[model samples]
Target: MPVEQAESLLASQFSIQHTYYRQHYPHGRFDIIMQGTKNIGRLYHDWSGDVVQLIDIALLSAYRGAGIGTRLMRAIVTEAARKHMRMQLYVEFDNPVRALYRTLGFAPAGENGIYELMHRDAMPFDEEAWASVRGLNNPFQ
Candidate 1:
């Protein structure tokens, strides 16, 4: 895709996502992912239902694989454990983060078109491991 088209497509996709979130999670909040003062990504989720659905989680290409994503996932998992809810998300099949989700105990739930639904059941939170990530201060304690 050309640079201009790619940017437009991304903007359009996010617009659609916002609309969907408004319809499904009227009170949901959008979170900006930041590294120090630098904005790095966005996270959109809803915990209104029995399951905490992760609608979107995106980090800039430069920040991928630096353990930031893992920390966020751990925080979600920890929260789910506290609330007795399952955590779920749909990930594109081509996305490498699928392995990270799997390693974190999410399993294949189903698939639709190019995306696979994955789910992790609530369990004990791993505070110690989450504390070990360099940039992530422990959120569980």
Candidate 2:
């Protein structure tokens, strides 16, 4: 989706307030969606790279620990491999969800206070793949 269209949808879906929007990101926004309408969810992000972001993954109030989060993550992982893009997201160091991301193969690439920049690609991108992956990774390449 175009940046304008995505922000338009998330403006309501994410209940984004104008103040927060202007203060935090004066430049851009994102595209949000869920998994297959199975209640499993996914958010697509293009922050200089292609990634499927996880957001507001909700389980019924009574379904807190029947492995829902894990299942949803795995689904995203499977899809990611085919798309040939990685999964990226932020999680506070103490967030229980951080453990889950580790389980699904994400590693800390950078940080923001208590949060981390995490990503997963079965094969950590090589010189070529990395160049195409997100356009960063030059680490003197």
Name model 2 segments beyond 4 Å from true: 1-14, 17-49, 122-141
Most lDDT-accurate candidate: 1
Model 2: lDDT of residue 60: 45
* Best-performing candidate as measured by TM-score: 1
User: What's the count of clashing pairs in each model shown?
Assistant: 0, 1
lDDT of 1 by residue, 1-141 (tens): 999999999999989988988887786668877777778888888877888888888889999888888888877786787788888899999998899889878999999999999999877777665545556433334
lDDT of 2 at 23: 55
List of clashing residue pairs for candidate 2: 35-41
**117: Cα error in model 1, Å:** 1.2
**Residue range 53-117, candidate 2, lDDT tens digits:** 54334444454575655654565565566567777777778878778778768888899998788
Q: List the residue pairs that clash in candidate 1.
A: none
